[model samples]
Every structure is written in C-alpha cells, then in structure tokens.
Target chain A: MSEERIWTAALVVIGDEILSGRTQDRNVAQIALWLNLQGIRLAEVRVVADRTEAIVEAVNALRARNDYLFTTGGIGPTHDDITVDAIAEALGVPVIVHPHARAVLTEYYATRGGLTEARLRMARVPDGAALIENKLSGAPGIRHGNIFIMAGVPHIAAMMLDALSGTLEGGKPLASRTMGCWVAESEVADMLGAAERAFEGVQIGSYPFFRDGRTGANFVIRSTDQTLIDACFAQLAAQLAAAGHDVVDGGI
Target chain B: MSEERIWTAALVVIGDEILSGRTQDRNVAQIALWLNLQGIRLAEVRVVADRTEAIVEAVNALRARNDYLFTTGGIGPTHDDITVDAIAEALGVPVIVHPHARAVLTEYYATRGGLTEARLRMARVPDGAALIENKLSGAPGIRHGNIFIMAGVPHIAAMMLDALSGTLEGGKPLASRTMGCWVAESEVADMLGAAERAFEGVQIGSYPFFRDGRTGANFVIRSTDQTLIDACFAQLAAQLAAAGHDVVDGGI
Candidate 1:
C-alpha cells in the first residue's frame, strides 16, 4: 500500500459571505466526499476572501503541489465573481469569452430574458479552457489544466459534479469502517494509539462526543485495503467489549 | 475609517475527519461569528490534515500575517490529538504538563476514573502557554502568544471563546445589512457593481439563491461603520426597487 501512488487534490473556497459568518460553507464537505469516492484524497482546503491577490496566491500555491485543484464560488455573473480573471492572472494567461459557453447561455436565456452583457459574463474563462457541464444553470464550469472552476451555489455545484462523476483518473478508493463505544476516548487513548501503530498503512481517528448527558466516542479505522480496516475494527471492538464498554456498531 | 487600525485573525482547522469528508466543520462559522463580535476580522481559513507538518506550516504562515491565529480540533486526549506538539514545534518550544491543568483534570476525573496517565494527557501544553477555560470540559484550551488552541468539540471551543471574550485588542466591529429581492442577481449586477464602487468604504456581496421555485438573492453590505453600511444598503435597495424588483428588507 505504501508503494501505491495516492492521488490528492486541494480546494479553494472563494467567498466573503463565508468569512463574514453570514453563510456556512457546504462546498468543502461535498467536494471532499465526492473526491473520496473518486479515490483522490482531499489534501487541503483554503477558504479565502473574494480578493484577486488572495485567490491568485492560494491557487498558484496549491495547484503546484496537488494532482487536481478545485475552486468554488465567484464564478457567477456578479461583479464579485472575479475567479476567472484571478485564475487567469495566476496562470499568466489571458481571459477570453468561451464560444461554447456563450452559445449555451444564448440558447438557455433566449426565452427567459435573453443573454444580456451581464449574463454573458458567465461565458468568460481563462485561455485554453474546456467546459464542465452544469445541468442546472446555463453557465458551465471551467477546466484549465488540472484546475476546475465551479459554481458558488451548492445545487449548481452538485449538478456540475454530477456531470463530472467518474470522469477523472484516480487510484483505489480509500476504505473505512467505524465503531462506536459509550466510553470516554481519553480512557482508551493508549489502546487506540497502540492499535494504530500495530497496523501499518492504517490510521485510526477517535471522535468523542457528549450526547444525552453521557460521554461516548466513535473510532474510525481507515486504510486503502478493506481487509485491513475490517480486521482493525474487529480488534478495536473486541478490546472495547473486553474493557466493559458498551460498543456500538456504526457510531453514537 | 481608512485611517483606523483593523484587526485580523486567521483560523486553522486541523482534522483528518474534516479533510476526509467524515465530518462537517462548524468551528469556522462559529469562530467567525464570535470574532465579529470581538471586532476582529476572520481574514482567512485553512483546513489541514492532522499531520504535524501540515499544522505547523499553516500555523506559521497564518500567525505571521494576521494579528491572531486560531486552531480548532486536534486538542483532544487521543493520540491523533497532536495540535499541542505541532504548535510547540512551530514555536520551537517543548511540551510540558501544566501543573494548573493537571490539577483541573485531577479534580474533574477524581470521581469518574481518577486522572490516569491517558487522562492526564489533557494537561500537556506548549511551554510558557496560558490556559483558556473550557467550562464544558476539564481540558482547558491553550493560548500561546497570539495563537489560540481550541478543542475539537464545538461546544468546548465555544466555551473557550466565551472565556476569552473582550480580552483581545481589536478595532471597531464590522457592521452589515442585507437586502433580498426575488430577481436574478445577474439582472442587477451592473447596478450592484456601480453601487459598491460609489459606496467608498463599503463592500456589497451578492449571493444568489433558488428557493421556493423562484430566483432570489441577498445583497450584503459590509463596513466597519454602521452609517456606511446603512447608506450603502439603502441606496442599493432603492435602486433595486426602482428597477421594478420586489425587495425584502432583511433578506428573504
């Protein structure tokens, strides 16, 4: 498993609404879950303000290291949507109006008010970019090199993701299994660490919770190999049961 | 307003669960809201893995640029909880078991299970660090220099934030007003851009939504000055109304 290549990606979430605490971001988790299914690990995520300098810096830094880089938000028709221009600056490319995007928008909005100049702004993309289908909206996502530009809206972003499912080259999907116990994770910290160290190419995460006036925790075992995960989970569960802790199968 | 000093903070969310899509992060929004009340701006946020190298890199880079840095998660008693060691490494300090923290944990677990070695792990902190009280949990948060190390649990982190309220030096709190309208943001993009440019010290962010089978958007006007925010929001709302759009005062 150590010899196997691990594909990784980074995400850049661009919005001031998030920084202002006015909106809770859902893109990071959605993209992460989607990437997990694709067998590409989400390496890191940066939530940056809607500033060109900030966007450019994050994009350049992450794109250099990861196999794929995704940016959500600031791709709309509003003036705050400066993702294309900033990405173009990052890549040292010029911004151009993509003809296919323009045609799509023209047809979609032909009946619903027609594609005005402001609406046509969605047609802009970095030079040498291809389109990612967005079934919900006329404005398509952009793909330039390994970078993907997605919508700020969750449903629209989901539509674009649906259009992109299983299209990218990825390695074996990460396998995981969870076991829950109504015991303080602190009480079992040493055991968890020992189990993790005992299993090569496997990691265990302990998440403690206080619910219904009781302390409990969920132990998640992760590895590329499902057999390893199953074996580790069984050992952990058996240890918890032996320790007189009430164990739950999935989570609390 | 431009002459007034502005305080900024960056948040580093350290968790493999978050990066793996196993958990939805609530700390970013909660801390963002709390910092807003403290008159400090959440300038940037980075979600990194539980790796010490990843945490250290994010901590060093963000803490240098911003007035304060906050890291949530990875503060538990499990072996995966390496935030203290990572930050200590970042600051070139050694980890020490704080006597005060040890006392707290001893009292807390006196009846439950006694402060065993594993439970005493909560007493570990970077040297020369002060403890931030976590009323919900005995494991106090750590505050070293301008960096605040908070708990992975949302409620514990909230308690720590509550303990530190009004303690940090900050500028005037940012003020914002939102107006919603049932119209495509694209239809009013030009007016929004023009309004923002004319507002001088204010910034307007247009967030579009598709709710209740209708297209709508909320325009948020933010500035440190309440008067500026009000003036900008009113002007934009009036402009939107005059353009034949139905406007809602506090967003739809």
Candidate 2:
C-alpha cells in the first residue's frame, strides 16, 4: 500500500443568521466529525455572511487552497439565498435554471399543486454545475468545480452529504490519546517537556480545568504511530503515578 | 455620522481537537453572540490545526484582512502549546519574555509559592506586544498588531474577551425580525417573492419546519433599516393570511 491518501478539506459556512446568532451553525462541527472519521482532515473552516462579495472571495480562496471545498447555507427559496449566484460569479459562469433541479422541485410541488415562481428559486443553479441529490427534500444542491454547496439545515445537510460521501476521497486517520491526572500542570511540566523531547513524532498537550472547584489537567498525546502513542502513554502514566497523582488513560 | 464606527473581527480557532470532534468549540459562537450585542460584527471565522505553519498562516491572513483577529488555543503550559512562538514567527519577531508579563505571572502565583521554569512558558511574549490581562487565571494573553491571542477554554476566553470589549470599537447593529405562520414555504412563495423585491435593503429568509408533524415556516426579515423591516413584515403577514393561512407575529 502506498499510504498515499491525505485528503484535506475546507468548510465555508454562509449566512448572516449565523453571525447575528439568530441561528447557530451546526454543519461545521457535524461535517468535520464525519470527515475526520473517514480519515479526511478538515484543514480550515470559514463562516462568512450572505454578502455576495464575501461568499465569492471565500469560495475562490478555499477552492484554490484545498482538495475539496464544502459550503453550507444560502441555498433556500428566499431572496437572501445568493450562494448559487455568488459561486457562479466566482467561476465566471452564467446563473441558470438547472433542468434536473427544476424538474425535481417542479414535480415535487406539482403533485401538491403549489409550484410557484417563488418556489422555483430553489431550482436555480450556475451553468455547468451538477446537482448533489438531496434525499431529505427533492430540491438538490449545486456542485461546481470542487465546491459542494449544501443546505444549512442540519438534518437535510447531513442526509444530502451522506448521499454524496462515498464519492469523496479520504485521508489517513489522525490518531490521538489523552490522559487526565489529578496533578497541577506545573508539577508535570518537566515530564511533559522530557516526553516532548523523547517522542518527537508525538504532539503532547496539557489542558488544565477547574472542575468541582478542584484544579486538574488532561495531558493529551497525539501521533500517527500506534506504537509511539502506546509507549508515550505508558511513560506519561508512570511519571504521573511517580509524582504521587491519580492518572487515567484514555485510548482513542 | 461616520460609518467608520463599525468595527469588524475574525475568529481563528486553532486546534485539531476541534476538527477531530474531540472538543466542541463553544468559543466562536460565544464570542459572536457577545460581539453582536456590542454592535461589533464577527465578519469571518476560521478553524485551523495545531501546526505552527497553519497558525502562522491564519494569523497573518486574518490580521491583514479584519479589523481584529481573536485566536484561541495552543497557549498553555505544555510542549505542543506553540501558539506564542508561532504568532511571534508570524509577526517576524523574536519570542522573548516581556517584563510586564513576567511580573503579572509572578505576582499571580506569589500567594501559591510562586513560579517555576514550567510555569514560565506562560510568560513568554513577542517583542513589542501588549499583555491581555486574564482575570480568571494568572497567565495573561498577548496582543500584538491586530491579533488578540487568548486561551481555548470557553469560560476563560469569554471572560477575557468580555473584559477587553469596552476598549474595542463596534459597528452599527444588523437588525432582524421574525414572522412565523402556519403555511408551508411552497404556499407563500409569491409573498416571499414580493417581500424580496420590495425590500432590497433587507434579507428575507424562509425557514420551514415541522412541529408535531404539522408544517410551518418562519419568515425572518433582516436589515439595518427598522422602517423597511417593519414594512416587509406587515406585507408578509397580510399576504400569508390572504393565502388562507393563519399568521403569528413572532417566532416560536
């Protein structure tokens, strides 16, 4: 095996509703978790307002920088939904009614006798874009270049992205381990320093928290090597116990 | 009045823990909400990893792009906590101990038997940087150029940012209105369409949902103009009832 599978992605969360705190963005965390599980690292995530210039700038930047670019929001049947137009403009393409998307929306509403020009806004797509089939609602999302534009709603976005995940390239799993000990960070600073020096391949982190009115710290060690991770955890645990502290191993 | 009073900021969340879903970043949303109340717009947000290069890159890009850049993560009494060094590298400055920071940390720990080399990691600062006083903990955050580097923990970051908010500049608040009704989005397309055309300054959005298996949609109108928002909401209400649907003046 070549071990040549390092896929990186960037997520651009659009909409002023998120910035204003009227609506919270759940897609970034959700997609990031899913992608991490699939061995793909989410390199960067940008949450911009629904402004067209901002969207166009962000879309171009992320698309140019990462292997895959995922965007959420501004794809609904309302005036503020301008992501499609902004993306099309960024790619220097024409905004048009995608036939299949139009067909899906039209058929969906036609059966219910509610298809209107307002509802048709959901069918608009940039020219030369493919539709990402939305299993939640018949209305599909647009895909132009490396950009995968999806809905803002968590349930719908997850379903649509799930229907499309198999097609995405993934990366090697980024592994980690964390050990929490009932010792102040200062008491274990030398141990953490020595561990960092010895295990150059691993990343060691200390997070101190004041929980239950008592201060404690979690020493997290991250590395791609399973052996290094295990060895380092053992060394760290022994050191903590030697320092007269209670320690617990968290294997990930 | 000069519109120059409008201040904008960008948040750069630096941690692989967040991307891996090992930690949920409540800092960004919390900051956004707080900033919004102060009439400051958090224009953009980026979540990067613990890598020095990534942190440096994000620091430079965000600082150059926004009025202020607030970063959380990679600053602690641990080896992998390299944000200070990375930020110094980004600003092309040497990471050295600032006299004031050292004094603050030393005084902070004076009651608890004082400082050590391990705790000294929290005292290092880039040349020409000011210290962001940490009220919750002894360790202080650094402010250089346009970037304010703070801790990753939600509570600490919130407290530090709140303490610093009075000194920061703010912007005109982006206003909003919520109009909920018992009509499916498809039925009110024409109303939504008319609202969009009538209020070019405002952003009209339709969020459809299902409550107890009954369908409903909330049409939210957002703008800087209060008159336009009220007018648009009035029109939207009348149109919904005219289309044979019950209307509610506010949100759920």
DockQ of each: 0.89, 0.56
Interface RMSD of 2: 2.2
What is the clash tally of candidate 1? 0
* Chain B TM, per prediction: 0.98, 0.89
Tens-place lDDT per residue, model 1, B153-204, is 8888999999999999888899888898999989999999999999888888
Stretches of model 1 off by over 4 angstroms after superposition:
A1-3, B1-3
Interface RMSD of 1: 0.6
Off by over 4 Å in 2: B1-5, B111-113, B196-201, B225-228
Q: Pick the candidate with the highest DockQ.
A: 1
Tens-place lDDT digits, model 1, residues A1-252: 453889999999999999989999999999999998998999999999999999999999999999999999999889899999999999999999999999999998998899999999999999999999987768999999999999989889999989989998778888888888889999999999999998998999999999988999999999999999888888888888899986787787
Question: In candidate 2, which residue pairs clash?
Answer: B6-B171
Candidate 2, what DockQ?
0.56
> Model 2 misses residue B121 by how many Å?
1.9
**The TM-score obtained by chain A of candidate 1 when compared with the true chain A:** 0.98
